[model samples]
Target: MNTASSDQFNEYASIYEDMSQWPFRKYIEIPSVFQEIGDVDGLSILDFGCGTGMYARWLKQRGAGQVVGYDLTEGMLNYARRRAEKEDLDISFVSHLGPELIGQFDLVLGVYVLPYATTRPELQAMCADMVRLMRPGGRLLTLPIHPVYDPHPNYYEPYGFRLIAEDPENPYADGERVKLELCKNGEQGGVFAWYWSATSLERALEQAGLRSLKWRELSASAYPDANQAPKELHAYLQRPHSIIIEGVRG
Candidate 1:
């Protein structure tokens, strides 16, 4: 875990939900992708980077035997813990990364976590840790930012996506640089974001020694009530937001 990313998230913790509108997190993204991975009944599940415990709660509702949530930001975990307590859900929250905190689980989920990784090696290491914590035949599911618009210039414009490449390579090794456009009050501004194409993500997973089960482009339209969402939010969803990947430890 990078201290820089952790510090950034910690600062964002108090207003993270407000900034992200995380209350609707599950509703705005891929649910079918999770279903396609198969029934999770009686399986131990881990929700990696589980902000506010939405996925952890969802997993329990889906019949997971036990659900554990882990994140780097203590503030996020604080909110998650409160939510779990209110719901009376038996979910455990951890502030650490890697297998030591996770142990073995039948299923693991990483939602919108990869893009936040600061470097290619960091992403690869996280993937490896996920695999290490899974039992053989146990599945790993991740939703990563699509490579297409990563480091994109227009924060409000739609970013298309492409399939991840299988070959491994360093995502940040070349001196390639791109400006990231951010929106504040509908105003566009630039920031630096490391770009990772689908290929970069796949390479990291392969380097972790996980076997791919399925890979697909996921859109918000695939979810129930997608059409009924606010027009602005619906449009954002239609644009490539993320890619869903399912793999298993060999």
Candidate 2:
């Protein structure tokens, strides 16, 4: 990971676990990821780029046989480890993934991971790592920022977030960087992430030997009490806030 991105998330570690429960993540991101993942009973799973191990814990709660969480940021890994210890959940949260992890998982999933790649080579390497960790026929699922999303200055208001184009000049041209500013009831924090189009992502995955790419939009109905969700999120019912990418190692 690049220094700036790493620092951003490392700084975010202290607040990530709490911030994650915000409506957007609780309603949209988590549900969408689980929908794509379906069932995990008795499966060995990897939570790639797992920040604070929230999904890893969820997997264990849902009866996954084994779960390993990996993150580049030390703070994130520490927080994840602390949580695992507190709950006595049998999860291994590691700072890195080495050769020993290759082909170790039946299901590998990442949330908001790919956009951290920052460059074509980085993105390709990230895909290669994900494919490397999966057993043949094992699945790879990811939830990432929608590539085609055009951020309007105030469009994110309903979600209590803002997206600013750091380099307005030539922004949204594949692999460009975008800044995501988070806010909830007046508190503020944010992170920088790379932008990747669907076409480019597919090419990278194919290059890494993953096949049968399937794209699914995040659904509002997937959220709990969908009818009670804010009107701002209603817009996402028509337009996507994020997407689920599912593929298989063959």
Each prediction's whole-model lDDT (CA): 0.65, 0.82
lDDT of 2 by residue, 1-250 (tens): 5556676787677567875677667777777778778889999999999999999999999999889998888889888999899999999988778888899899999888998998999999999999999999999998767875656645676677776677777656788778888775675778888888888899998899899999987765554665677776776655565688899998
Best by lDDT: 2
lDDT of candidate 1 over 193-233, digit per residue (tens): 34466677788888887896577655454446667766666
Clashing pairs in 2: none
Task: Evaluate model 2: give its TM-score.
Answer: 0.92
